[model samples]
Target: MAVGSFFGSFDWSAFLNALILGVSIASIWLIAALGLTIIYGTAGVINMAHGEFIMLGAYSSYMLQNYVGLPFFLCVPAAFVIVALVGLILERGLIRYLYKRPLDTLLATFGVSLVLMQGVRLIFGSDPKYLAVPPIFTSNFQLGFVNISAFRVIVLGITIALVVALWALFYRTRFGVQVRAVMQDKEMAASFGINSDRVYMLTFAIGAGLAGIAGSLFGVLNIVLPTMGTGYVVQAFLVVVVGGGTLAGSVIAGGATGELQSVFAYFTNDTFARFMLYVLIVVFLRIRPQGLFAPSAKRR
Candidate 1:
């Protein structure tokens, strides 16, 4: 009787909705973590200012949309260019000097984060800013048993495109070969005439540019603010760490974590779901500290 009663109360429709929604959640985390993965995996820099880079992306979009009268579509790429430039400048000016000094790089980037936050606060004040989107994005549509926002679908599309592009960049080009060589053994890559320094500069810029794209999308999901990146950064870090700082790892971790969280929330509540998710991550890490994919022996 008890088993029957439990079965009778099950809401298959809601569960299905949550399951589909998990994909959207996964995309959000994955997109945000993409840049962090590239930076940490390739450059070995614990970029504490990555969140600030994200914030800069959001503000860049906001500025271009409002002041320059660019549409949201144009703002996305523009944000990438602007933030990538900032990243290049940062690497050239400061981060390049701190290579192999993990603690110093972390502390320095943390200082950079503070500077960026305060600088933005001074320029834009504390009030939240909003990004405008098209009416289509504001609408909801049904997909099988689930109803989802159009914007989420768009985000998912963007995430897929990014992953595909990154895969090509990592596996299909001469630059990709150089990046992997550098990632595996900087000295070896340098021996072959691949400039390790140039690779690092370009990779860092690309990573920061990815964060910028994430920011533009995320700004539509929530109001833009100097501190908006804080919340997203936590989840982004989780994806990167759990995935072992590899591109493929981030993708798998993002999807698995997002789905697990969604299912947990479906069974319980949001807060408890998050608590349970964190507990699971802790346990998972305790057993496999290297994450989903361990680095090659050369990288180690």
Candidate 2:
């Protein structure tokens, strides 16, 4: 197990290749985790329907590309908007009613997710949809023996851009100030004449919207199934929890989570790696009881 003996002649080239793959996975996790971090940080609501929102995005993108015959570039933002709208509608309807009863909020959002996913199933059947990368994007280069796909590179680049844009919006805007206000102390924010209800609604919508965009991008980069969002939702929460309860915490958690999952998947069975990852999360939560970097003031 000594460092020098662990690899008599380690290959730096292979190490770089693995690093590239790790970056790809990490970028995706950042998007998925953004949804949870925003909603949980701003509104203190654990929206279970978050995944279904992603499902909505993926399907929206599918419809735009295939059914509407729109171009691929157009489908990207349209998918984001469509998902954001779904989140908005859900907030105005079901989410508002269950806010006071948090435990019920979970059930309500879970119901929304079930309903949304099942609705897709009924309308589209259980078939998976596909998105074709544009010709210029489809062509990729080989680095020595490794073949890197164009779509994977696109996913990583877009995810990085999204993270930067979100970070700016959250930390730089008045909207962000109001959101942080409510997050820090809802009752106090309301007392100071801030519109708590409206903020909550918008915050939730953004969270759902983020998930939707992530799902759509995921579909483009991978497979599009009705249950596709389910895998991501679980991953998102794990990232959020592992990182901590704050927005920044989620990012930190997501990167770590994605890296571990990637490394494990390479050397171990995917199923076992996934299980142990969750087990590790549970153990960490038990030890800290407030995520790795959760705000002490928000601790219940």
Candidate 3:
């Protein structure tokens, strides 16, 4: 009788809501991981400063909106451009030099991350900043048994659009061929007249730009702080690792992790859910270290 009563009172609506929310969570993580996947997959650079790039994007949007009164939509693209330029400069000045030494690149990017965090704290005074979006996105709407945030729906839509755009960019463009060529065999690509340096620079810049867009959306989802990027970066890394350095892998890993976390949290608390997720990831990695989608033989 007790078990039957418990089952009878189960909230199917809440389950539906959690499922929808899982999609939103997956969208956020996928957006964050996409850039990392591209940079790592193509260049074999594990970017330790990716979180800082995300922070810079949020701050970029805040600065534009506060100082220049740019609309939210405009600020999104502006942040992308700003961060992409930063990425380009970094790739040219520092990252380009450290490519052959993976350890040096890792340490250098870690230093860059510290510098960016401190710089933001100095400039912004360690205060939390808020991004204002349009009123239409501020409200929630009910769809059947689940209530969903309009902003989350917008974010999901944007993520889907970006994914499609990235796919097209990677598959249907001449630049894509150049990037893939460089990824497959840099020496061979250079011999064939493909400038590997130029390709790496552009790829890093695009990766950073995608991080910027994620940051822009994230700013709308939560308060922006110098340390905000740290939280998201961990999840992004997990996605990239579990997906195994591929674009399609990132999408699948993000969705799977998000849904698992959501479902776990629905039954347990958030802290426990996270703990469980980490444990599961650890066990999975122990068995299949190559991840869900392995990179090509050349990438290995």
Off by over 4 Å in 2: 1-12, 143-147, 296-300
Worst 10 residues of 1 by lDDT: 291-300
> Candidate 3: where are CA atoms >4 Å away?
1-9
Better of 1 and 2 by lDDT: 1
Clash-forming residue pairs, model 1: none
The 0-to-1 C-alpha lDDT of every candidate, in the order given, reads: 0.92, 0.79, 0.91
Kindly indicate the candidate among 1 and 2 with the higher TM-score: 1
- Every model's TM-score: 0.96, 0.91, 0.96
